[model samples]
Target: MIRIVLADDQAVVRDGLSMLLGAADDLDVVATASDGSAAVDAVVRWTPDVALVDLRMPGLDGAQVTAEVGRQAPDVRVLILTTYADDDAVLPALRAGAAGYLTKDTTGEALCSAIRTVAAGGSVLDAAVQQRLVALVGPPVPAPEPDIPDGLTTREVDTLRLVAQGLSNQQVATRLVVSEATVKTHVNHLISKLAVDGRPALVAWAWRHGVVH
Candidate 1:
């Protein structure tokens, strides 16, 4: 089962999430916290596989809790479950080590899938969140020369560009007229060539290097 800790200041939200996630046969709501500090404490105490954290709380915010978890329990993946998908809210949590993010409007099944994905060392950004992120990140400031990574094939660069635009592998495949497996292979290659962690990191690199602008 995927062990989880839920942190949200609103009691109703906490309870609703608890019931919703608990109903999933493969998920266990191991603990719940009402504030950021408590969320960190619960994560440290329970060492759950995933922590569902809110963006705003009294003692510590989502970004703070994510940072604390990264420091105190690096193995525990954090998934930001928040109402806000604004760039200001999403970027910090992600930079602070959150593995995935989802708006509260996410369907119950999709939320569970996100939790499982995070626990399995994958990252997810809600479609809305992804769009907000790109808009917020904005077009990169033009440099004298684009800092393209060396040794990347043209196809890999094309894949990277699509990924930077927040397209999923399937979408990228369709756009490129390639198989999904081919897109995945190109993504893996780009990740290695860029020396980044995952899709998020790859997107960050693309933004920094003006690859997507």
Candidate 2:
């Protein structure tokens, strides 16, 4: 079974998620937290496969909890399940090493699938969240932008575009009609070539360089 820790400030939200996720045969709702600190504590104690966390919690907030979990329990994956889908909220958590981001409006099946995906070391972003990411990245600039970074081939550029759009490696592979390993290779190469830390940083670089308007 896939172990999970659900964290939300609302008691009702936690209860609802517990009930919903608990009913799944392959999932176990190991524990629940009403705040970010407690969420990190639970993760450290339980070392669950995934921690479904909220963005707006007292004490630490989602990004703080994500970073803490990364420090204390690096093997555990964090998947943001929150009401906020804006870039301000999403980007920080992603930079903190969150495996995925999803809004509260996602269906139960999608949420479970996302948790499983994260457990399997895959990233996820809700369609609404992806749209907001693209729309809120930055103000549009004029065309004929700066030159592309050196050593990024055409395929790598395509992969980077999809990554900035919040697509997972598997999704990018499907979109490019290539293998997932190939997509990961492109991502790693771009991260090295662009000098960014991770996917969130890559997205920020894309905006700054006019790669994604």
Candidate 3:
């Protein structure tokens, strides 16, 4: 069974989530909290497989609780289940190590599925949350035809430009809201496609080809 601690300030929300989650044969609502501090307490006390947290609460808030849970009980995963999906609400919780994010409007089945996913050490983001993250990274700049050298993808071009501008792999990952491993993959592909030896050569090639001016 996937154990869960449901936390939300509203009693109705808490009760509703409890019922919805309890109905799933594979899920168990081990505990429930009506505030953030209580939520964290329940999590630390129960060490459940997943903590389904609300974004805003009286004491700690979802992001703060996520960070605390990560520090105190690293084995437990956090999944944000809140009404808010704005940039300000979503980014901090994600950065604080939330394994999943879903709005309250999510169907009961979807929420249960997300909980299972998080418990299994995977990540999930609601469609609205995903869109917000994409918007934060901004759209890929369209390079004019013929100006797109080496047939690189738009994302690769973006990576190349950032790399040419002296961004490290980690920094590029932060700017693009992706993983460092992903950034490294892009860099490797760029080197192979452009016949560059390494980063310095890539930078030189980018400058020479007017990819980053």
User: For each candidate, C-alpha RMSD in Å?
Assistant: 4.1, 2.6, 10.2
Candidate 2 on 80-150: residue-level lDDT in tens? 98886774777778879998889998999989889888898888877666666556656545559644777
- Write the residue-wise lDDT of candidate 3 on 62-112 in tens digits: 999999999998999999987867748677787788877899889988888
Q: Who is ahead in lDDT, 1 or 3? A: 1
Question: By the lDDT metric, which is better: model 1 or model 2?
Answer: 1
Model 3 stretches with alpha carbons more than 4 Å out: 144-213
- Could you tell me which 10 consecutive residues in candidate 3 have the lowest summed lDDT? 137-146
Best by TM-score: 2
Q: lDDT, candidate 2, residue 34?
A: 94
- Model 2 scores a TM of 0.85
Backbone clashes in candidate 1 total 0
* Backbone-clash count (model 2): 0
- Rank the models by lDDT, top first: 1, 2, 3
The C-alpha local distance difference test score for the whole of candidate 1 amounts to 0.86
Q: For candidate 1, list the clashing residue pairs, or say none.
A: none
